[model samples]
Target: MDFYLAAVLQGLCFSGLALGIYLSMKIFNIPDITTDGSYTLGGTVTGIMLAAHIPQGFILPAVLLSGGVAGGITGFIHTKLRINALLAGILVMTALYSVNLTLMGRSNLPLLAFANLFGNWALTGSQGPDSLIVLLVITAALVFLLGYVLRTDFGIAMRATGNSESMVRALGVNTDRMKITGLAMANALTATSGYLVVQLQGFADINMGIGIVITGLGSVVIGETIIRRFRVVQPVSVLAILLAGAVLFQLALAVTLTLGIDPTLLKLVTALFVLLIVSLPRIFQSRTA
Candidate 1:
């Protein structure tokens, strides 16, 4: 039971990351690799603050704003300087590594003694349920706010721009600004995940974000597959589907580890899993053809 509960908690910790990837990859049709940097940036900031006995109240917003700035720089480079979007993300991600290292002053920081959202007495439950409840609140509130935002006029324009940039530009929407704003919002959410994760795991590492975007992408692909298979047509249902996908993804990982797979091979396994997810749709199309 504890093992399964831990898997669920892991999913909830990464829920924000899955949503961020959904925004950038599915909604914007861009593989915004800024996720790798922004995630660690959040963890680094939160870890540093808690170590200094700083107020926890400002940690999340600081992390979110830092992530937004990182993403905004990437967007500026891509839109204003005509750099390829992928390259722009890579550049920012590389630069953020240095920034994160500088802030952390080391490769990792332990938060086991830190006062955190899930560690307080206000939760009124055991550690497992308490963690799950807090994460659920954050996830649910984010999904609600995201649904509201996506239903607004500007959000519609953002989606339209993603669907057809030329059409949206002709319709007088500033596609560049939309892209920039979307990237900022996406990274902010990604950073929020990082903040949650460092708190849950009791440690923050510089390498925590390494290859992490793949996990987010896999969760997203899994979510999309479920939504399509079930014919879930509501825009809001996507959020629920994503939450479920993250849980299932973590469960799958737990199963692999339980099966005695070498821990060192986990990254390779993830890569293959992501490859399978990416190609399954194409394979299905070919079979139907």
Candidate 2:
């Protein structure tokens, strides 16, 4: 596959991760670092199930629930134990490394010949971009579903809890409950991305989730820039931009690779991209002021 096309497909796979970050960081105002662990957990579960010949459809719920549990643990520690949110996430993430290894029974699992969601089937093809098309459709559907959910009364309460915990609680909402729910949902979505990535890449590695949060953050930053420029605050608008940001970030990496850049510098480049994303808003605001 062409680098550009592959990048687009790659973007679609990671789009869910971006949405997860947006939910935890931007919406819930929590930096649930459990993302790193839950992501690997998802891939671990998926690889194990697929390699074992489990029906593909039956495995997704397991993947989601696994991530939710990881997130819930983080939320529990943060809310009940009063640990710092970052520390809570770190604790869970650290534990999950061992948990993931136990689940996989090793450091790596290969699905090279396993039938996957992106593999040839009666309804789907195995040609180039087939996975991309599958992922694109799923990603679009998720965006719409997420947009609809965010516009609901419960969703408004969730959003409110993020914006102002006191205000929401005064209105009879359970702030702690909302935070737990939000974090679980965020990590569940993130795990779904891992599920897709492992299948697409044909293997699951114990270290795959390391620093993945940075990639997701970069995508969210890119999306935020577009929204800030247009001043659109709608949930649907945010979702659209996030998806676009994921694609753009992937495309940038693909372009760099195509230009013959050393793969070793990719991490450095990613860090610089994130720095730019973080700084650009402040830079623009200062100039305008």
Candidate 2: segments with Cα more than 4 A from true spot: 121-126
Clashing pairs in 1: none
User: What lDDT is obtained when candidate 2 is compared to the true structure?
Assistant: 0.90
Clashing pairs in 2: none
TM-score per model over all chains: 0.97, 0.96
lDDT of 2 by residue, 156-225 (tens): 9989898999988999998888888889989998999999999989999999999999999999998888
- lDDT over C-alpha atoms for residue 40 of model 2: 97
Candidate lDDT values, in order: 0.90, 0.90
RMSD of 1: 1.2
By TM-score, how accurate is candidate 1?
Answer: 0.97
Q: Over the stretch 104-191, how does candidate 1's per-residue lDDT look in tens digits?
A: 9999899998788788745765888888888888899988888888889988998898899999999899999999999999999999
Lowest lDDT block of 10, candidate 2? 120-129
